[model samples]
Target: MTFNAEPFTYRIAKSGDVHISREGRLVVMVRGNAAAKLAAALGNGDESDQQLLARATGNYKRGNERLAGSKRR
Candidate 1:
């Protein structure tokens, strides 16, 4: 079996932490707790309230990166 290379769309914006869509429609908007975890997976520094917020809410986007076991800082 084969899967589509681009099955889903991922957007990271300051206005809406993270926006996920399939077939060009907003499927889910992750904020609060969920967003925090996703943001960390994208690449976040240390675990702290302020750091999480910065990662969760900002124009910064992690679109070009992939989830990895570890990344060089």
Candidate 2:
């Protein structure tokens, strides 16, 4: 996927320290937790919180419908 370089930013933080970067996607690690891991658990990459939530919700709903339909067959 192609993203606009000027329009996107990445925020990396650990504890109280934070780093802001214009790079699209990345991994920020502090101790054992990384931003990339957090994003994966939430679904996809460094998308905005709202965007990730919407995508995850849509994926869940679609998966549920698919499973339900399969079970009915």
Candidate 3:
């Protein structure tokens, strides 16, 4: 599976809240120390930052696994 983080974007509110959005839709609003930490981590806006955003919005994989079985021909 491949992950594309381009659709994720964030903005810092005046009250120090981090507003995370995906595809132009708001996903989560982070506040307090967590918001500060997230803001710091998102500085570079690289792959790792994307991953952090994904995790913050509960968009990451949940560890459930199952390989596709061979189809009967």
Candidate 4:
């Protein structure tokens, strides 16, 4: 028999919190340390499958000094 996996979806609320849901029901709204962890992971991980996650929670540091716009002094 073939198997199918359930799907999970998530979004970031206007209050800067992350909400995770399965089957259209909210399972959890991650905040505090949990939200922080998710944000950190998004910054470091490949997120082709998690476009919403990045849009909602990723806070990445700029990698290049020249492009970041600051004097080297």
Which candidate has the top score in TM-score? Answer: 3
lDDT per residue for candidate 4 within 1-73, as digits (tens), equals: 1114424467666666778676788766778777766655543323442544433433422346566677656
Per-residue lDDT of model 3, residues 1-73, tens digit only: 3465387888999998999998899999999999999887887856777788888887556665443344646
Among residues 3 or more apart in sequence or in different chains, the pairs in candidate 2 whose N, CA or C atoms overlap within 3 Å are none
**lDDT of each candidate versus the true structure:** 0.54, 0.38, 0.81, 0.55
Specify the poorest-scoring 10-residue window by lDDT in model 4.
53-62
TM-score of 2: 0.20
Error of 2 at 34 (Å): 7.7
Q: RMSD to the native, candidate 4? A: 13.8
Error of 3 at 48 (Å): 1.0
Residue runs of model 2 more than 4 Å from their true location after superposition: 4-6, 16-73
How many clashing residue pairs are found in candidate 3?
A: 0
Can you tell me which runs of candidate 1 are displaced by over 4 Å? Answer: 43-73
The order by descending TM-score is 3, 1, 4, 2
lDDT of 1 by residue, 1-73 (tens): 1232444455777854767665688666778778766755654323443334334444333554454445758
In candidate 2, what are the lDDT values of residues 1-73, reduced to their tens digit? 2233333333444453223222444223222344355344542444464343333233323445557657563
Candidate with best lDDT? 3
TM-score of model 3 relative to the true fold?
0.75
Candidate 4 Cα deviation (angstroms), residue 30: 0.8
Sequence-dependent TM-score of model 1:
0.45
